[model samples]
Target: MTSVVTSETRFVRSGDVDIAYQVVGQGERDIVVGIGWVSHLELLWELPETVHFLRRLQSCGRLILHDARGTGLSDRPARPATIDDLAEDLVAVLDAVGSERAVILGWVDKAAGAIALAARHPERVEALVLGEALATTVARDDHPEGLDPAVIENLAAAVEQGSWGTGALLPAIAPSVAHDPRVAAWWRRWERMSATPNMAAGMLRTLLDLDVRALLPAVTAPTLVLHRSENMLVPSAAVRRLAHDLPDGRLVELPGADLAAFFGDTDALLDEVEEFLTGTRTGADAGRAVLTMLVTDVVGSTALAAELGDHRWNELLDFHHREVRAALARHGGSEIDTAGDGFLAVFALPSRALACAREARERLAAGGLTIRAGLHSAEVVHLGAGVRGLGVHVAARVAASAGPGEIRATGTVADLVAGARAEFEELGEATLSGVPGLCRLTRLVDARGDA
Candidate 1:
């Protein structure tokens, strides 16, 4: 199916927050894509996985996409938004878009909003498609599939420590593509653009504590609950319980570890989603993707700039920039973006990322500059405009941990470049702040003791 092209973002008033929304199709029915995943509506099209999923749904009916209160392009409320607020916000979004009825499709974690709306305002919902559904999040003996409070708290801590909008949660959410530089880079951008770390943490805590099992039985519309057999974030049994509880719900177990509805066998997801919503299906494929990334930034650049003075600093910065760009091009690295004196770039191979980092540092150091570089290679979503998802966040954090003039990389990158001329020293395991789990870091060194 041909995906929807980029379009302008419009807004509707939902209390104080201006809920951003967009409509992509003019089919006979309406399907409101309830807020799910950390989102940015405009950037969603930039991802093929989401575009494919959305386009297939559009074929079934008109598709309504929106930023929930306090996230994406929507206005931030003075206080943290509640599940009730997000649910009602969906109602206002439907009304604003003139959607009297829609198949409310909710993604994981946000599934409660869809359930709440359907239960209280059944008149507004034609049906429901809940992927990665959960009636309650906190774990219990009977509901062992639910998220544990400690796990939730750890995630909250990671977010608080500046990991929320940077795809720091990628490994937990979608390990299948966790390190893909293309997918990871764009995901990192989404994190930064989605919401502040504090707001995200508060929102997560509120959502985690919310239990809406009582509301499930009240939903009058036909329902479909699709859960991955191996989704790490949300267990399959939890979705099974959800399916059994909803008055008119049916369950379909998909095969994959990816938690994102748009990643991993997206066609299967949209197949079930479209079939449930419109009683038909169009198998839209989310095609191939994988990427490797290396992010470099000058250590103490501000102090260096001050000491060097403006004129000399600008000249030096320009020289470093030109030299780095040349080194990257030489090593088949694509310039992803530049932030001040630093560069965020990509390579098709871990060796290239390593080589470019080494070459760039060597050239810069000779000119009296020092730099820090980080490398990691993994699966990613290669959106034509840009790459996105988890890999970039890990790489950025890895880069931040490096000492001056050192090139630090994850074991994943080092393993990938094994047998290449590059030499590596094990830095052992350390908790990558804002990232879940400890990581085995390694430093890439040349024989002369430079990155």
Candidate 2:
């Protein structure tokens, strides 16, 4: 069974504050992950993507995950925390774990603290890795690399009044998984658990005001700076400057606009990190993969069963099941489950799944029966002789939303089967129950101009 990770979280005294930290896996080398802005050590494990990312990192080295002072489970600073405080908090965690030297992978504002530690306490930092690293947040006349002051202002406003605790900012940070209801809901709770609206806004302002450009030159550790090519917040030229300013820095610009490291194309991001840390990029787990899902349900099955009585309905259902099994075999789909008058199956190719769904609906219609089908492509956890994941839930929801004799799919299905000669009619956005946000649904039309 695929389950969310739970670790024994502990706290260490960092000056006057108690910083919460979790140690995962055991290795000769240690990896201190500096998650920036806001985070909750326990709530983050609720996300499957984060679990996968952490497990992969554990494969490479021991992971030292912690929430910064004044955030998550840590004690709030009596005064506005400074960059010096952030660096010291990290050092304190290292001491608690007995890690004399470790690779520091800093993200966003936390990168400033990492750079400070590398410069101030060079012996403790074995190597440095940064993602979406910031040199300066506010633009200045002397430093053309800084961000526009308005950008930070708008963000502060969002956290303070607009969308704090709602996960509305997820789209801006991680657009790739914005449509997934499970992730959306978890992120909403994560936001709430991380900090209150006022405290979050205050932390945002404090972190943005941090400037680490001066410390870059003093970092003696070999540094790898990773930044997204189409980052929404940080300008590419500015990140390039950050790399150039560092004495022993190497810059690698990855694809995607998501500022969060574990969001879009996570495998690609992890590949880089693992290679940089251990000189080998570990392969992904064999049990997890992206698969296209198809779910079909007989419309008004209860009424039909009542009208036809037990014997007649049973005979008809048996025929329908046989036909569906034949269709699955013909299209290379693996039938995962059959619940009452519904069928759930998975296909390796989106086009094949679409074709099978269309064929099964047509076959059932010809037999005086009709089914509404839904298709979606997403990552799935392969269970013993079956599969499960958010994609399966999404497919079931899409199927439920379809009209009788109609086929519907998420926008992702349309994107995946682009050249399959499939026609799709926009069904617009829908607010599915149990799903956090609106999802874009599309009606799949038959290629032969048949409804």
After TM-score superposition, what is the CA distance of residue 85 in candidate 2 from its true location, in Å?
1.1
Question: Model 1 misses residue 225 by how many Å?
Answer: 0.4
lDDT of 2 at 136: 82
For candidate 2, what is the lDDT? 0.84
Name the TM-score of candidate 1.
Answer: 0.62
Best by lDDT: 2
> Per-residue error at 35 for model 1, in Å?
3.8
Clashes of 2: 0
lDDT of 2 by residue, 1-451 (tens): 2332446999999877899999877777999988878888887676667766676677677889999887889887655567898889889999999999999988888888899999999999999988888678666677777666677778889898858988888888888888899899988888888887877878777755888877877899999999989888878877888888898988999899888887887778888887888787654564578999999989999999999999999999998899899889989999999998999999999888988988898889899999999999999976445776888988999999999998899999988877778888988999877766888899976566222
Highest TM-score scorer: 2
Which parts of model 1 have CA positions greater than 4 angstroms off? 1-3, 140-145, 285-451
Per-residue lDDT for 1-451 in model 1, tens only? 3345545789998877788999885878898886574678888877666676676677787789998877889887756666788788998999988989888888875688888999999999998888888888876656666766777778989999978767889887777778899889878887888888887777777757768887887898999898889876776777888899889989999899887787888777778776666566544433334567889988888998999899999999899899999998888888888988888888888877887888898899998889999998877654544566677888899999999999999999888877777788999998887778888999976544222
lDDT of each: 0.81, 0.84
TM-score for each of the candidates: 0.62, 0.67
